[model samples]
Target: MNMPLELCEARDPKGLYKLARAGKIKGFTGIDDPYEPPINCEIELKQDNGICPTPTLMAGKVVTYLEDKGFLEC
Candidate 1:
C-alpha cells in the first residue's frame, strides 16, 4: 500500500478504505483485488459490538462446534 499522499490525512484503524478512496494504494485486497466472501465458512464471527472474543471464548466456540458434530467429548 502506498503512503497516504496527503500527509495530514486522518487514518482509520486499517487505512485501506481511506487509501483506496484517495486512489493512493493499488493492489490492495478488497479495494483493487477481486474478493469473494466465503459462502460456507465453518466459523464466522461478527464484531459489530467491537467485542472481540478472547482466545478462551473462541476455543469454546470451536469446542462447541466440534461437540455438536460428535467429534469429541467435553
Candidate 2:
C-alpha cells in the first residue's frame, strides 16, 4: 500500500503520527525515521486522482497480479 504522507497523516486513526510529531514517539517511520519506498516491488496499491480505491478494487488488483504471475492457482 502506497499512500501520500499527507493522506496517511490525515488518516492517523491511532494518533501515532500526532504523538510522533509531538516528540512523544521516537523513531517513527515517516515522522522521524526515513520512509524509503521500494525500488522494485511486485505490486503497489496507490490512490488515483486523489481518491483512494475501495478495498475490493485494491484486492482485485492484487489477485489479478498474482494470478497473472501464477502465484494463485485458484
Q: Find the candidate with the highest TM-score and give its number.
A: 2
What is residue 28's positional error in candidate 1, in angstroms? 8.9
TM-score of each: 0.45, 0.81
How well is each residue in 1-74 modelled by candidate 1, as lDDT tens digits? 22232421443557766777678988765566755667878876443364555557777887898999999977
Model 1 clash pairs are: none
Model 2 per-residue lDDT at 62: 93
What digit string (tens of lDDT, one per residue) describes model 2 on residues 1-74? 89988988988899999999999999998899999899999899999998989889999999999999999998
Worst 10 residues of 2 by lDDT: 3-12
Candidate 2, position 69, lDDT: 97
Residue 21 of model 2, lDDT score: 96
